[model samples]
Target: MFGDVMGMMGKIKETQQKIEETKQRLDTVLIDEQSNDGLLKVTLTANRTIKNVSVDDSLLEDKEQLEDYLVLVLNKAIEKATAVSEAELSAVAKDGMPNIPGLDMFS
Candidate 1:
C-alpha cells in the first residue's frame, strides 16, 4: 500500500539523519593514552588521527630507548583509539541499522 511505502521512506530518512549525527559525535571524540611510567603520551582522534604527543625530557637523551618507548606509547594510544572508535560506531550502528532477520549475528 502507499501508506506502508511512505512509512518505510520516513524510517530511511530518519536513519540517514542518525548516521550523520553519529559521525559528528565521532569527530568530537578524543582518546589520550600514556606509557606505564608516564614518560610518553599521545592524543588521538577516534578516527585514528594523531593529534599530539609528549615525551619526557629524560627520554630524549637516549635515542634507542626513546625509539622503543615511542613505539610502545604509540601502539598503546592506537589501541585505545581503535577501541573507542569501535564502541562508538557499534552503538550508532545498533541504533540506526535496518532490522532484518539474522542481522544481529553480524553485530
Candidate 2:
C-alpha cells in the first residue's frame, strides 16, 4: 500500500510538471478573431494574452462603433483562446493522472 502511495505521488508530481510545460507551450498558440464587417481584428495567445489588434481607418471616424467592434472581436478571441488552453491543459492532466479506483474525475 505504501508503494502504491509513493507511485501515485510520483505520478502527481509528473503531472504538475507537464501542466507547467503545457502552459508554456500555450503561450505560443495564437488565436485570431475578426469583426463581422472585417473592420477590426484581434490576435491572442492560448494563455489569453492579447498579441495584436488591427483596425481599419474607417473605424476611427466613430467612437461608439469602434468600441463595439473592439468588444465583440476581443471577446471572441478570448473565448477561443480559453477553449484552446483548457483543452490542452486538460488533455495533459488527464493523460498523466494515475489510475486510482473510484476517482474518475476526468470522466
Candidate 3:
C-alpha cells in the first residue's frame, strides 16, 4: 500500500510539472490577429498585451469614419486575441489546471 501511494504521488507531481511547463510555453508563444480592414489594428503578446497599432490611408480620409474604424478594429482585435488565447489555454484546463478567478479562466 505504501509503495502504491508513492507511485500515485509521483504521478501527481509529474502532472503538476507538466502544467507549469505548459504555462511557460504558452507564455512564450505569440499570436497576432487583425481585421480585414487595416484602418485600425492592434498587436498583442502571448500574454495578451497590446503591442502596437496601424491605420489605413482610406479610413483617415474621413475623421468620423476613422474614429469608427478605430473602434471596430479594436473590438475585432480584442475578440480575435481572446479567442486564440482561450483555445490555447483550453489545453491547460483540459489537463486539470486550477482556475485563476476573475480572469474568466475558461476551459
The whole-model C-alpha lDDT of candidate 2 against the native structure comes to 0.95
Candidate 1 C-alpha error for residue 58, in Å: 1.1
Predicted model with the maximum TM-score? 2
Model 1: CA > 4 A from native: 1-13, 105-107
Best-to-worst ranking by TM-score: 2, 1, 3
Q: Residues 1-107, candidate 3, lDDT per residue (tens digit)? A: 68776775676576677767766675665555555754466776556667777777776789998787767766766676667666766665555533334545443
Best by lDDT: 2
lDDT of each: 0.80, 0.95, 0.64
lDDT of 2 at 47: 100
Candidate 3 RMSD to the real structure: 6.2
What's the lDDT of the predicted structure labeled candidate 1? 0.80
**Model 2 C-alpha lDDT per residue in residues 1-107, reported as the tens digit of each score:** 99999999999999999999999999999999999889999999999999999999999999999999999899999999999999999999899999999999986
